[model samples]
Target chain A: MELFESGACDLAIKIKTGTISSEEVTKAVLQKIEQREYDINAYITTTPELALKRAKSIDIQRIQGKDIGLLGGIPMAIKDSIITAGIRTTAGSHILENFIPPYNAHVIDKLLDAGAVIVGKTNTDEFTMGSTCETSYFKPARNPHNTGRVTGGSSGGSAAALAAHECIAALGSDTGGSIRQPASFCGITGIKPTYGRVSRYGLIAYASSLDQIGPMTKSVKDSALVLSVIAGYDNRDSTCLNEPVPDYLTEIDSGISGIKIGLPKEYFEEGLDSEVCDITMKAVEIMKSEGAEFIDISLPHTEYAIPTYYLLATAEASANLERYDGVRYGYRAENPENLYDMYCKSRSEGFGIEVKRRIMLGTYCLSAGYYDAYYRKAQKVRRLIKEDFDKAFKTVDAILTPVSPTPAFPLGSKINDPLQMYLADIYTISLNLAGLPGISVPAGKTSDNLPVGVQFMGRVLDENLLFRLAYALERNVGTSLTYEGAVV
Target chain B: MSVTRKDVDNVAALARLSFTDKEKEELIGTLNNILGYFDKLSELNTENVEPLTHILPVQNVMRDDEIKPSLDQETALKNAPKHARGHFVIPKVIE
Candidate 1:
């Protein structure tokens, strides 16, 4: 395999053993980024000079026989939402187009401490409000598998970069399938750790309760390895669990024999593309033949997940986004008459159309006289969704479902209709609403040659179980996707 | 209830945002369409269920009132649109 095409784990070992210099690997990946970035639009900023400097430093450390942390010279991409000190981290939004964070997010610090070199900041949906990267102030990231289609977003850039071999692995934040759905679309392995699994201190807030930072990689083992580096407690984010991070890399190799996987009936019903369903079922058959048990289960409240998620996410988003007035940082409107006018005009001129729409909806939901009917009710339904998963986990070790109803769709297909775009997240939204961990691993492809992925949803903090199942499925039935732009 | 143009205007103001007439018209249609989806949640009886504010069982993290290192005034105001005398400059409110 080409140096840039090697999995993160493989590249890490080679770099650590002095078999390949970190500079060489970083150069090859940067070359791939230069070659593919024009067509893919996979990054908002490419820090080539900084990446090379970090790579050379790691190389020097290896020569000096010093401890080079776990990742040791791996060129990794970061989603633009995570704040990196001195790097322009635009959450694919115009308001913060020139914003450079003053400090690194907790995960960025962890990844850097682990010797991961920062390649650049990947693109995202503006404030992560949409399912596709089309909402970005910068144009959408084209799916690497087929350049005409979208890399399902709002982590589209990270997914595309990983699939196109522009980076060894990438970090993506998930709030209602931003990471997993895009991973599925781009034919990569992405895991959204359990709520509070990773710190949110430096993340650009988008639906704070649902947002999670996780890893998007080319291999299941890499996902486990990256998650291990990024996961654990941080004093900065109060919601972060103080539990001990487990050894996912060692646990991933364990077989899936006798592991019970549940097939939720609602996921298989109408709206799912036939080819996507068939591919997911084929994965189930492979696991079944390997002695894993599949049970037919019903998460009866599944139909309510979309509404519940939209209401709560937008409500929280409205409040979370209220800080972007023309006061401190970000875009400020000119010639405002007064304080109120300044706040209104700065936000109106700075935000994109979909962002404005979400802010309005969120505001209306939480407004006086309507709170009980919308925001409060959604929270109640969210509880029911959580209870449904809690009930299912009583009998099954994990729940298996398709990551999206269909594979990568052509760009501009669902961008106009907000409702239709929201529906695309139906299969993945339930997991986030329930605050659980899930992994999207490639299953196979559709007849059109588009990639498809199946999700393994686990109980809260049970990422180890999800990793084991995803690893087995990836080994048994994973598609080896190759794109035309994958030449290193 | 379905969102109307008036509601969009009011909500936009509450959100500290403004829109053109055409954008307002478009928002009225889109907001109502999305709000219509929320009606689906009404079908489920959540009468007895308590609202889940946070998923994890975490509570307020109290700590000693000790001084800690933080961003200095200059670094904190580095990205500010307008700053002078170690403070953010905003449109005059008292005046």
Candidate 2:
């Protein structure tokens, strides 16, 4: 395979062993980005000069007998939401279009410390409010498989970048299936670690409780390798778990023999496309052949997840986004009649339609008369959803479901209907609400040749199990995409 | 339970956001559509269920009182739209 076509794990080995120079790999990826990025629209920014400079330095360090960190010299794309010191982190919003973060997010520090070279920031839905990249203030990232379709968002750009071989691996933050859904669409492996598994210090907060940063990669093993580097506690984010970080690679190759997996009946009942259901069941058959048993389970409250998520997530978002007034950083209105006018005008003009709608919805939910009726009630139901997982995990090691109800729809299909778009997350949002870990591994493709990924959700902090199962599926099913170095 | 235009205006104001009349009218429909879906939550009995704000078990994540270096005035104010004398200049609050 070409340098840019290899997984991060393979690239890391080649760079470490001097079999291939980091400079060569970096050049190949930069060239790939130059060639295909226009078609995919995966990145909001591309830092070719900085990436090459970092790659050269890492090459020098390796020559000088210096330790090149875990991902040393590998080119990676970061979700624009994560703050990068001195880099324009727009979070795919007009409000922060020209904003440059003065400090690195916690994960950026870890990646830099590990010697990973950052290529650029990937596009996302404005403040990650929408599932499709169409909601982004920038051009939507079209699926690498089919340019006419979306690369399922709000981490759509990251997924597209990886799938298109524009970058070896990428960082994606998931709040209500941003990472996993795009990975499913782009035919890549994406993991949304348990809520507190990764630090949230630099991630532009959407819903503080639901937001998490994880890895999207070419293979399940690459996800494990990247997750190992990024998954650890930092004092900057209080919600980050102070638990011990496991070397996921150690237990990754462990076979999933006698592992009990659950199939939640609610996920299959309605709204699930027949092809997606068949693909999911086919993935189950492969796992079953590999000695993993499947059990019928009921997450009775699954139907309520969407409503619960919209209420709670939007409520938190309304409050978290309140900091973006014209005062500190980000866009400010050109001229204003008064302070209130400036605040109102800057925000209304800065934000897009979906973001404004969410803000409005959130404000209404948290308004004085509706607090108990909406936000509080959703919180209670959120507990019930988590309880469903907790109860099921007692009987099964993990649960299996389709990552998205259907594969990537056409770009403008559901953008006009907000409620219709919300239902797309019906299957994935429950895990986010429950603070559980979930991974999307490419299963197969639809008749239209679009990719489909099956989701494997595990108990909190049990990412190793998810990786093991994911690896088995990838190994046996052989659904790995052929990177022919061509952009459709 | 329907979100009227007046409610959208109130919420938009509460959010420190202003919408054009057309945007407000659009929001009235979108907000009501979303809020109407939220009515599904009321069907369940959450009478005594404890609300889960954060899923993590850790709370009151305290740190020591020791001082640590923070962003200098220049770096902190670097991105501010209006800054003077190392302070963010904003329209006068009490005028």
True contacts kept of each: 0.93, 0.88
Q: What does candidate 1's lDDT look like per residue over A1-488, in tens digits?
A: 78998888888999999999899999999999999999999999999999999999999999999888889999999999999999998899999988989989999999999999999999889998888788999888988889899999999999999888899999999999999999998888999999999999999999999999999998899999999999999988988999999989997878999999999999999999999999998999988987799999989999999888989898889999999997888999998999999999999988999898888888999998899999999999999999999999999999999999989999999889999999889999999998999999988878877788899999989999999998888777653334322323
lDDT score for residue A331 of model 2: 94
Task: Give the interface RMSD of each candidate.
Answer: 1.0, 1.0
Which parts of model 1 are misplaced by more than 4 Å? Answer: A478-488
The parts of candidate 2 lying over 4 Å away from their true place are A479-488
Error of 1 at A90 (Å): 0.8
How many steric overlaps does candidate 1 have? 0
In Å, residue A111's CA in model 2 sits off its true spot by: 0.6
TM-score of each model, in listed order? 0.98, 0.98
Cα DockQ of the candidate 1 complex: 0.87
* Docking level of model 1: high
Q: In candidate 2 chain A, what residue range of length 10 has the lowest lDDT sum? A: A479-488
DockQ of each: 0.87, 0.84
Scored by lDDT, the top model is 2
